[model samples]
Target chain A: MLLPSRFSRMLEVVSAMIMDLLGIPPQVLFGQLLIGLINGAFYALLSLGLAVIFGMMNVINFTHGAQYMLGAFVTWMLLAYLGIGYWAALVLAPIVVGLFGIVIERTMLKRLYHLDHLYGLLLTFGIALIVEGMFRYWYGVSGQRYAIPAELTGGYLLSFMFLPTYRAWVLVVSIVVCFGTWYAIERTRLGAYLRAATENPTLVRAFGINVPLMITLTYGFGVALAGIAGVLAAPIYQLTPLMGQNLIIVVFAVVVIGGMGSILGAIITGYALGLLEGLTKVFYPEAANIVIFVVMAVVLLIRPAGLFGREK
Target chain B: MPDAAGSATATAPAPAPGPRPVALAVQDLNAYYGDSHVLHGVDFSVHEGEVVTLLGRNGVGKTTTLRSIMGIVPRRAGSVRFQGDELIRLPSDHIARRGIAYCPEERGIFASLNVLENLLLPPVVRPGGMSLEQIYQLFPHLAERRRTQGTRLSGGEQQMLAIGRILRTGARFLLLDEPTEGLAPVIIDMIGKSIRTLKGLGFTMLLVEQNFRFAQTVADRHVVMEDGRVVDTIDNADLDRRMEDIKAYLGV
Candidate 1:
């Protein structure tokens, strides 16, 4: 073997030390961080929906992932079949998906209300399987890419990081949606009624709330939020039928780690865990796949109710 | 000794007769749980401003009657008319919006919500809602624990919170089940006083109680049930004479 040059060896050692100390190059690190934030945004939105459904309806909504995939597919069909643009699809997707949710609630979910929570979970799981299977049969496992809209196609270079404009828009839109939902549930008069019904539907009905309608609407709204998240995610990820499947598992973990105690808690835990996963990617690439699960295990050990969950 | 007090009043003549303007009317009401028929052809009516107590032992259908009125349980056949409006076909929430309120035996308070949130919940409608000061006046203990979560409240405080919450809804009629169950004597006394105060305010009440002594002090009329049917309807004037029968039926 040829002897290595002393100066080249010295340079290699310095760069390796720098990489170890700084975790990763600034561009790679910030890029991953940005991606993490994007992932966090979706996580926050999806988990918020799950928490809302769980709180008021006491349904795990295993169909949530399927509904989210339906949102993306609906948007695609709107564009391809109806010549609708992204903006219109953004508004139409949720309404269509929400109405679908309402129909499900009226027919299938209504029957399971008096039964065990497991039955609801099992029913929704079967729904998820049916939905996913149908989509796979039509679209196949290979994902189709969605072109970024002309208006959102540019990018901005900041320091060493180049941020895509569409990604930034996704970040901004998701935060607003998440906070808007949180405010509706936490601060509004309607929210009070929702909360009351969740606690004691019988008493709330006596107060004239029309609880069955409220239950249907609440489930619809929660599903609509997931649908919104799906639309936002369509351009960033491959529009595959399997897209929402993996995301939902992470979101469930985020919900458990957050304790599903408060809406705000679910959102915050989602983003925070997402950022931690990003950091893990830079420092220990091997752990990136399950950093969220690891964090969930740690949280359960420390506080079984979750970080924000109240101890009974 | 309490039985003697009831008999002393029993000999008095029945108070003024004839149906007062009906506040709530239940005709041939029948209800069931799965295959078990719990309420059968139950008939009763409460006049405006009247305090009617449905008194019976644990399983004699007093609670079921109140639940059926509120549409909490499924009614197989019947007409429940509240203030001349048909309630049997209406959903529970719609029935509630018509100005009927229920305080369940479980004292269903939202344990996660603070006392003030619980009180603030029902009176969301404008113009005739109960204010924090009014609820405070009714149950000062609730006022003290306004910021406290519902689970932290004592049983008496939870009962007060439950009643106090319904009062805020501007509901003209109240359905209260076992308001004094599992409470200390002092707390029960406070609840008794609150009921009297509420009666003084012109609120119509259907109180279900196993505590005959407590019911005796507050009820204007008593309807006793056995086997999902009303066995006797005693005016306050006749409460004492029926004590032996009530004691035997209630097994108290």
Candidate 2:
């Protein structure tokens, strides 16, 4: 009996190796692709926020990751402590984070407005450390799992793959959020003012636009977008302190590849890069992790300002 | 030349019967840039529909005066009044909404945005100021480059776009700094024509120019500034007689 069990274990190992050598099953491959698409959605949202803040205000916003983590934590706390549902948390989290951004802008960012862009990056980095440290003190480094809402607990079966309802919802929500922001800044009247102010604040103010107020609002809106992405991510990933920290580097890579020319570029680059990463995982598992950075390096070498970047 | 003088006199219509309104006045204005007092007790004014020019050599605080009036520079102590309304304490946008517009030395155009986009920008503030057709009529070259990016335009085209942008804001008072600073002679002539056209439309102007020829052609009165202080005010009628003093003061 012991010999037969050992043989069965060896057979199991050999089958796994064979499966690795051969192409992954279509079902498993598509499953990984779907996961990659979801990740792409998050990357698109986060990078779009970064682009907006950096393009208009010339602020790098290092605290964006901390704000994203705070969004998840806020949503988790709302559900666990206050008995708020997922829908309510989704609406409330962004408002809370946006208000927090307003405070930061008024108190700290206002002081650094006249300084160089590097100072804004450093100050925000410090703020990130302070916020993360405080959250770690309260919640500790261990992660907590958030329950999937009752409405999104099931899955739908496709031809070869099963798509979870919650995952599908994440994709839809992120797309809406991303496109909505792009339209607001690209196609509207207010967008013209924001772009003009970004180019020249003094001249914009002379046109009767309160540019300082616009700056504050733009920063707040960008931060709020990150918060919304965080809430969407809470159910998929383990709710932890370091969740946003790991993701932000990849989003930055996305921004560098896209070159903050227009909002559409950021979104498209993010999603396409994500899909490419998914394909990489299928063909060569080991290179999957570094694929985005590799793409970024190539983009830098080809077009330093990025695909849509303007030459100075 | 009576037609020219008559047109110039007709350019500055008298203030309507009211409570002796001061159209645009700056009194005892002081400004600083990181402890260097650039504007020291500067004083000046412009009446309704008057074409006033601010003349000074480089670094004599001519641009600073325009900035202070537009609230771009930090004012330490001064009052900027327009039609008896206090403008010093208000923010730049509020001051602009009160009908003051500024064109800086750099010709701040949204380089990435196209010419039409730049023209469409200020109209959001005053939707009825001027239509695209009107802007096209004012600067035909801008009409030709309507879809071209602002950065792609030549210097003359950029100046036209800058002036056209402000005009679209429905601003009656224009503070233009060195509009003809660096341009081809033909471009200068084009700009001069536009200025004359704008003057015909009865717009008030506070122009800063280094080109005395351009000023002589456009200005109704000239205020000479030296080291942030108004040295003299000369009407266009006395301009030829004071050429010696003007040359002595300006070193031109």
Candidate 3:
């Protein structure tokens, strides 16, 4: 301890300061960790959809944020307008948005495949603007409260923290859905076709598979995933029309860190980064906003292809 | 210039006997890459059970001619008739459904997929393709590494898998682009033997090869392409007489 260099001594002092700040009472630490995990679940779910859609069609899906907002909006409309509860809206909202996604692909996105990648990104950006604009005009950018379903209304008192039953349900269901999607795309025969089509649609099509239709369906599925996440998020967050606006940039960073087109990477990185974000809030609240971007820069410096992206 | 190898083929039976039916027929096939014309009025045909080779130098539209048949490369104007049906208007997959299989130059193997998955992926185009057992028997090395990812196979093994993938499609007509390319001599010999086996099993092939020697061994007929058009057609029996023409066009 007496023989350390000046730089090493400085590093130790800084870490010691960090450790002291990070050392929290169990209640606060556990609660924050759970919050981070919940955020990570949303991140993984959103980024997984982005990766899937990007893999098949090479589209960046700028409308993902809009789709997420639409999920909450759809859920709200179902509950307020039609008196539909959260349980049924959870199942229906995503399907509606997914069908909208299919229509977008068939009418707009399909025409852009032969052109530059920027065209697709720009078109989706425009669509997102239109969707969010329409919602803002009517809803006035205010937060809408979604009542948690009766089944998931209570909180669980764990030894370390008070875990809201709905938040726990969201975490568990998101993990299940994310893994289910990964399994469908990685393990099943249909997944094999999807992966192959992503690599070489021409070759896959040559084998009598309807690759174009599959691409449309894949876009639909990705949008549906975004919608599902939105539905889950409605109860936890104040359901603002602008909720997805800021969250998307963070989700995009998560996708970049995880590696675009790498499913397992996306899932793992999403949760891990969310947990890190949570820890940052407890240890260094001042650096919380830009923490993911800093990690992204470091990861990029080491591996330009991304954490799991294959360098082409 | 007629080598000693020509004698064995000369003495053997014609590659396709008794009123050979045309499996594919291309007429005035014109293709373009954007504004640049690639194939200019190219015409060729492969008969039932015949192994036809399209020989040309690099960048001389040899590969384009094969892609034109598969409809992978759109033709500016021409007719591609497969099994008495017009193929020029059909989509690429529709063309494949007509019992024509294409093996692209890159082998087009999915690196993410295993050998068995790759082999089983392509839908059988017709009913005459080699069975999985037959494919395993033909390339035991493939069977040995069935669970290995497609691109993980040795170049020769991948080539065999590429060829074997289409054979399982039951497609009687196979478009193979440079089957001997970048392969070791031993692999070339094995590939030549495999082509002979396919020929024996009545597979019709349209091969595009810069490897003239490999072409001579498997091709029942040679169609020499220049720039884009069919410049010369040398039946196996007549190649010796046309050696000067082949040499001049292909620079072989």
Candidate 4:
């Protein structure tokens, strides 16, 4: 009887500290986690594109944020100017951005292949700045709002919290896309050619594969992934000229933590770091923004190659 | 410069009765590595259904000759004719499409792919290449470790996989560079037996070798090189009589 009373007293003290001192209920914590997962969906998508591009071309592709912003702008322009719907924009936006990426590869990026990687990075960074400047000039800093589709406008009431239908759809679709890409690159016959080319392009060429063409298509595919992420993000986030700027930095951090040029690493670390950031927000709100960077530093110190990456 | 030794040997057939058509002919081929020249006026020829070995001391352009033939070298001039088609201007992929497969000295096996994936990685440029079953039958060790990563394979198994991969590409003309470079004695014997088996299957091959004994076991002729020049061509039948000459040329 004395032991039971003492245990109850300890539990009561802990509960009081959690409720009164912390001021965040379990429901609120769970809600932030769901929101984090939603953000993570986009991170996984964007970083996966970066990893694929880096894996194949050995180019850092600093223009990825601009490409993501282009995806969102294309979706908005299609709906506003051409009266196209969200469903069509989802498919069309990526294709348009992917083609643009192809042009960039063929005209500018190909010339820098023989040079050091820093040149490619500088060139792409400049391109990103120019593209962002043009968009900002066209459309001012204030963001345009995009309404959610009719089919996914409402919220679903759960026992713990209210979940938006669009956010839930984002989580599901991004996970599917991420895993689908992993399967394609890891399990398919074409994937074998890509993997072989990645290892030794000269040998693959001697085997009669057009490795340059494969590189172009890979860059296009990676850019298209960013476009898809942008379209998925459109309904939730505002359509702004500077929208992709801040997000891209975090995505880069995710890539660095995951390991450069590691596809599965990008996807896994993206989602995991997003969740970690959410937990940080619950416990220490001021450190939420820097939690991912701290994790990145720790991971770098522990394993420079990353959790899933192999050393080159 | 014409290959005078090669021309003289063509008149007297040692292995076969009649003269088979030339499958590959290199004429005055000169290649450079940036400002450094590697091959200068190197000349040789391999007849159809024949296994020819390019024998030389280290850095005498044996590997460069093979790479130049495959169009892998950065700057190579002069003519490389394969089956009446001039390959001097063609890119490596186009040359491969025209039926010349190269197994490099380093044995370029993709570590990312499994053994089976590595075996099946090269696209079939022609219809007459070996099927999967035939390749598996040829290299039983490969079939056993089909799911193992390419680099995880032993040296002998990797060599077999490299040769088997080219066989599946339908390229009857193979340029094998040092296939027996770093293998155990038993594995080298197996490779020699496989080369003989492939010869019986009517494959034409040009090989580069540092091991003269290994080359003598599989080759129909040995073309000796000195400083990127083909100085002599000796038939395999005359190999025993010319062993001292070869040792001098190879500086062994």
Q: Estimate each model's TM-score.
A: 0.86, 0.87, 0.92, 0.93
Instruction: DockQ for every model, please.
Output: 0.40, 0.45, 0.57, 0.76
lDDT for position B225 in model 3: 88
Model 1 steric clash pairs:
A206-B96, A208-B97, B6-B240, B7-B240
Candidate 2 chain B, which ten residues in sequence have the lowest lDDT sum? B1-10
* Model 3 Cα lDDT, one tens digit per residue, A1-312: 123477656755665564577666656666778999999999999999999998899999999989998998899999899999898989999999999999999999999999999999999999999988888888887788888888998887644457899999999999999999999998888899999999999888877778898999999999999999989988878688788888999999998998888888889999999999998888788998899999999999998778989999
Q: Among all windows of ten consecutive residues in candidate 4 chain B, which has the lowest summed lDDT?
A: B1-10
lDDT of 3: 0.87
Model 4 regions more than 4 Å off: A1-23, B1-16
Give the winner by TM-score: 4
Candidate 4: residue pairs that collide: none
- Quality class of the docking in candidate 4, CAPRI style: medium
What ranking of all candidate models by TM-score puts the best one first? 4, 3, 2, 1
Better of 2 and 4 by TM-score: 4
lDDT (10s digit) by residue, model 1, range A200-265: 777777766678898999999999998998888777787989888988999899999998636888
* Top model number, DockQ: 4
Question: Tens digits of per-residue lDDT for model 2 on B1-252?
Answer: 112212343233444466434579989988888879998888989987778899878888899989888887865568888888888788788888888888888898887578888887764454446666777777888988888988789999999998888887778889999999899999998787778767766678999987877887778789998998888999877999999988876888
Give the TM-score between model 2's chain B and the true chain B. Answer: 0.90
- Those runs of model 2 whose alpha carbons end farther than 4 Å from true positions after fitting are A1-22, A260-262, A297-304, B1-21, B123-128, B131-133
True contacts kept of 4: 0.88
Off by over 4 Å in 3: A1-23, B1-17
Q: After superposition, how far is residue B96 of candidate 3 from its true place, in Å?
A: 1.1
Candidate 4 lDDT for residue B169: 88
